[model samples]
Structures are given as C-alpha cells and as structure tokens.
Target: MTETLTTALIEMREDDVLAAVRAATEAGTSPAGIIAGLQAGMKTIGDKYEAGEYFLSELIMSAEIFKRALAELGLDQSAAGTGTRGTVILGTVHTDIHDIGKNIVASVLSANGFKVVDLGVDVPAQRFLDAARENDARVIGLSCLLTTAFPAMRETIATFAAAGLRDQVSIIIGGGPVNADLALQLGADGAGISAQEAVILAAKAVEGGVA
Candidate 1:
C-alpha cells in the first residue's frame, strides 16, 4: 500500500495518490508511514528535477500531489505542531512572490514533525522577526528564487541580529539563487538546495548545530 502511494506520487498521479492515501488511512496505516512514503516519492521527484528529467511544471505538479495526499490524510495546517520537535518560521523574503519551493519545504518540515509558521510570499524582514518571536521558533527559513532578493535575505538576517535574537534562532536560506556561501554572506547559518535538505538542516539547527 505504501509502495503504491509512493509510485502514485512519483508518477504525479494526483487522483491515484489521493485514493492511495485514503485507502491506506482506511486500512489503519499510521500517518507517519503514509508521510514517509510520500516523502520518498518527493525525494525521487526532486532527483528527477535535478537531473533534468522533470521540468518546473512537473515539479509543481508533484508538489501539488504531495500536498493533496497530506490533506487527504488530515495532516495539513490543522495537524501542524502535534508532537512537533520544534517550530520553524518560513517565508519568501521581501519582493519575492514565488512560493512553490517554500510551500514544498513547509509541507516536508511539517510532515517531519516541525511546526511551520509560513508567513507567505513577499514577506518583509520585520514580519519574519515578529513571527519568529511570536512562535519562539527555533529556526527561520528564508526562500528566494530571484537573485534580486538576496539583499532582502540579508536584511532579514540583519533584523534578527539587530533585535538581538540572532543567537536564539538559526537562519537558513533556500531557493534557486541561494547557496551556502550566499547564506553565510547574509548571516544565515546554512542553506539547502532542496526541501529534504532543509528538513535535515532545520533538525540540526534546533539542536544548536549548523548544517
């Protein structure tokens, strides 16, 4: 059943994936097991995207399937924070309206037991700080697909530093234009090329370690 779910997701069969998730749930499959299967599928999808076997449209479709499966399993925002390992505030930095990558990261993190406070796209630096402070998040993830948003990422990090909260939380940046060096330059603790890596980085961040 799990394999079916994974296959359905990897194939971007939205209806099939939804059916598989529903069937698994009715069969009393654990939510964690279902989520793990979905993550496996997403990992394959990510790899295909990187290898150029899948394009942006396909990637977006896969993400949508993943989200639908999660919703079918009753594990969307309402289920966030339940048995969570920690809280993470995530958003696209100012002037960036792109959110596909950020949404994927949020779903993966939430599935992995991290409560995600998604501040949405085109978010300002101050809003990130406010959400982090309100949730006492252990990590902040900034997403930006445009090179022009690098400065915004820097400003977001600067705001954290200016507020004297830099040390209290870890900052990680992602999206097409972000890299480890860029993250460092912007005062972030780390950067991830994919949502899977972001989950690992966020885990390390919560443990007071950098990835």
Candidate 2:
C-alpha cells in the first residue's frame, strides 16, 4: 500500500494517489506512515525537477497531488498537529506572489513533524515577524521567485533583527533566484535548493544546530 502510494505520487497520478491513500488508510496505515510515503514520493519529484527530468508545471502538479493525498488522509496541510516537532513560519516575500515552491516546502515540513505557519504569498516583512512571534516559530522560510524580491527578503530578515529575534530563530531562504551566497548576503542562516533540503534545514534549525 505504501509502495502504491509512493509510486502513484512519483508518477504524478493524482487520482491514483488519492485512491492509494484511501486504501492505505483503510488497511490500517497510520497517518504518519502515509505522510512518510508521500514525502518519499515528493523527494523523488524534487530530485527529478532538479535533474531537469521535470519542469515547473510538473512540480506544481506533484505538489497538488500531494495535497490531495494528504487531504484524503485527513491531515491538515496548513499547520502542524499536537505531535509537531517544531514550528516554522513560511512565506514568499512582499511583491513575490509565487508560492508553488513554498507550498511544497510547507507540506514536506508538516509531513516531517514540523508545525508550519504558512503566511501565504506576497507577504510583508512585518507579517513574517508577527507570525513568527505569535507561533513561537524557531525557523523562518523566505521564498521569492523574482530577483527584485531580494530586497524584500532582506527587509524581512532585518525586521527580525529589529525585533531582537534574530538570535532566537533560524532563517532560511529559497526560490529560483536565491542561493547560498545570496542567502548569506541577505543575512539568512542558509538556503535550500529544494523542498527536501528545506525540511532538513528546518529540522536542524529546530535543534539549534543551524549556524
């Protein structure tokens, strides 16, 4: 059942994924197990995207399919549950309305036991800070597909500094235009090239292991 779920997701078969998830649940598969299967599938999708075997549309499709499967399993994609390992505040910087990558990262993080407080796209710097403080989030994920949004990302990080919460949280940046060098220049702790990497980085942040 798990294999079916994973295979359906990796193949981007939305209907198959939903069916597999339902069957898995009825077969007594735990929600965590189902989520784990989906995560493994999403990891494959991310790898394919990075390898050029897939495109943006494919990535978006995979995210959508994953969301459907999660919904079938009765999992809340918006926020983490009681067993959440940690809390993360995620959003695209102001002026950047892109959120496909952000949504992928949010789903994967939630699957990995992190509570995600997704602020949605085109989010202002202050909103990010406010959500972080309100959720007591230890990790912040700033995403921007536009190079012009870099300043917004910088401003968001600066807001954290201004609020004196810089040392209390780990900030990670993502999106097409963001790289390790850019993240450093923007005062972020690190950068993730894919949603899988984001989940790993967020987990490290929760452990206070990210520099």
Q: What's every prediction's RMSD, in angstroms?
A: 3.6, 3.4
On TM-score, the candidate that comes out on top is 2
- lDDT for each candidate structure: 0.83, 0.83
lDDT for residue 73 in candidate 2, whole number 0-100 = 66
- Model 1 vs. true fold: TM: 0.73
- TM-score of each model, paired residue for residue: 0.73, 0.75
Per-residue CA lDDT of model 1 for 18-60, tens digit only, reads 9999999999999988888887786787677667787656666
Q: Candidate 2, which segments miss by more than 4 Å at Cα?
A: 43-58, 78-85, 95-114, 145-148, 194-196
Q: Write the per-residue lDDT of candidate 2 for residues 117-203, one digit (tens) a residue.
A: 889999999999999889888899999999999999999999999999999999999999889999889889999988767867887
In model 1, residue pairs whose N, Cα or C atoms come closer than 3 Å (at least 3 residues apart or on different chains), thus clashing, are: none
lDDT score of residue 54 within candidate 2: 74
Q: Quote the lDDT for 7 in model 1.
A: 95
